[model samples]
Target: MKRLMFSVLPLMVGLALGQAVPASIPLTATATLMMPDGEAAGTATFTQAGNGVQVTVQVSGLAAGNHGMHVHEYGRCTPGVDAATNTIVPFGGAGGHFDPGMTGNHDSPQTDNMHGHGGDLPMLVVGADGTGRATFTTDKISLTGENGILKRSLVVHAMPDDYMSDPSGKSGARERCGVIERDSFETRNYPLPGPQDFPEGVAYDAVKDVLYTGSAANGTIYQIDAKTGNVIKFSDGGAQGRNSALGMKVDASGRLWVAGGASGSISILNGDGTPFKTLMTPRTPLPFINDLVLLPDGSAIVTDSSRPTLFQVTPELRVRKWLDLRDTPIEYQPGTNLNGIVALPDGSALLTIQSNTGILWHIDVASQQVTRVMDGLNNGDGLVLTGQTLYVVRNKDGVVSKVMLAADFKSGTLQINEPLRGLRFPATAVLVGDDLVVTQAQLDKRQKGAPETPFQLTRVKRF
Candidate 1:
């Protein structure tokens, strides 16, 4: 009997001979439900499964009864004044039910055709303990495509759905709401022109929609079309006294500022790769100018890995040793002392990372005072600051750590370390849209022998 049932199952589901099965792509989203008083309720999750979507919901702190749950048009869960009642309503900003097909009818999840709302689902039943759990699959909704539910809201109504009513199944007020957000994970690689170029720094030109990368093996600057991924040599090797380009940035004047590693120089070039200016730093201490950050006032601050100092370029293009950490709380080690630098949003202070000791330092731009902020980031090579968040790229670890900095720049908490699979000695990164294009310098492989041919950059999304 079991064998007979198995044989007839394929026919029951309308399976055809030699039919190709669709591949299931990994896509997921989650939402945290909150009550009107900002109280925690429960959570809901959505996952792509075959040709359908799997939904799991767990709710608590509600009356023991049936409730209507659905996806709304907007992701907002804030309270707003209701037009009909002229009173403030909870989660009213979520708007109406999600109806991509503009269907005016409220029906069941098993409803055929596009006559019913896509967000309609089965009724949720709460137990005596005021807790409810549901797990189901529906073909009417999806995580992508025209009926994608990303950035939408999941609402739980006060009353159960009748499964056959106009508009919203006559469901009562929305008691709990949560915005569904996608879990982003995407990676791409763009090949460079040289076989052993060993690119170090990356910078993006938002206005021109192009990307620029520098070669550490030589001084060649490569320009890449952002949309097409086409590469072109912007400048030849050793151009404008740039023996090695370690860090780079494009200022507001559309000029590219290149950090000359070991050459103790800062080379400025026009957008067309013409020579603008080259400022040489103190050659004594064997200056290894590694990375730099442009300030809001058109000035720039660069980190020196070999020396215990940071070089600043004034708005008048004058170079000076802005802050020296020799007498400060930040202890500088022997190898690669400071690698990456970033200025805070308010321009009051700056942040730099030490590669050898893994200490993060905060410096006051006005007083030039330096203080230790955090540690345990050994091998931290590049730094990117967005608001109060800091992204630290650890070269040897092959991972980028996301850190949440305190408002006063006194402390920071490490969030998560996102690993790049094929990353080889990543030096620095620049934001392009919602992605991070990391320069894979491959310095470790270069030291061993002939590094990998045709060096490339890795583009990571949602890292």
Candidate 2:
């Protein structure tokens, strides 16, 4: 681990096959190995590198020779008696082996073979002093995405492996086991571009390994290549007249949809600066289109801060008024009603009323009927929904709340992490790998004087 930290690394293109890989983050997963007799064996730490993973193993009380080390499919270590041997096998519940692609071959980890299992790891060698310490790196495993090994189990074999076995090597019984779990720490902050421009909306494209954010001053969209940390203007949003953006999202099609704050239009742009499509909202007095939620079919439910309405844009590029939250007590702010919106697989949306003191409202997209989800958001600016967890960015509070939601959207009372640090009035945010790339919009007026520094995006690690 010390060598890896000081050595210079090269850019990695990732695995052979095209996969959904999240932006890189410093992830370290540890496994405390315990023998069948409950003896402390050792520990393994998997830290994510540039485009690969660096595994550091420090073990004691092992034989002074080569031993098999593999990541098992299941994050469990069950003790069961093997029928053939009639002996208790420790870590039996860890399953056969981790093969995200089900490639039934176990090859040498040093090889450039793409047909091998994702969990194929290098061998571990113990010294004459009964201590094993080594660091190995591989591009097959990642910390995020479908093929990630974050939740897998690391196992040590009772004997050495031949390295060319079909499923697993002749490496005997599973000895020590560790289940990979997320470990968190404070993240380093990266500043955005403009000072007073206040970049508002943010989105992430995992495939491209890039993040896109829009400015509230010029409606220009800038793409930040996560790998190289290169920031460049991707689009001027000139096609959409008066394009001042507030919220943004990249749909399944990889197209960028930006909400026109006062322009009252949704501008669609390709990954490049080219124009894709545009949906115009009904002209209302100072129509403030704040945020939007997308459906699987490419349709979107948009929030209008000026009007007590929710706008729907069909996949066919047709725009229509969907719902109205007129009568509901939504903590209405004339030009800033709803700020952030999260769409569910069930077709409902959870919207945050920024001006209403972080009041979240759940609206049935179909019926337009609204229900209060929760309150006490602590100056919630933007929202992100991953699985069942709802992360609300509290701009004024200078932290992020990781909220676990109940099955019913009507009520979501859960424990949140002790607020995260290092955010200066962040606004819109999107998840990329382990980092929540957010726009430091400073819309909440965190700074009293001039725009302190050039506006910059904040990359936060959300657990």
Best by TM-score: 1
For residues 318-425, what per-residue lDDT tens digits would candidate 1 score against the true structure?
A: 999887778788776678888888888878898999999989989899888877889898899988888788889888765677789998986999866554433556
Question: Model-by-model lDDT, in order?
Answer: 0.78, 0.69
Q: What are the models' TM-scores?
A: 0.60, 0.57
Which residue pairs of candidate 2 clash? 191-456, 192-455, 192-456, 192-457, 194-455
Measured by TM-score, how close is model 2 to the native structure? 0.57
Q: Provide C-alpha RMSD values for all models, in order.
A: 20.8, 19.5
Which pairs clash (backbone N, Cα, C closer than 3 Å) in model 1? none
| Distance from true location, Cα of 86 in model 1, Å | 83
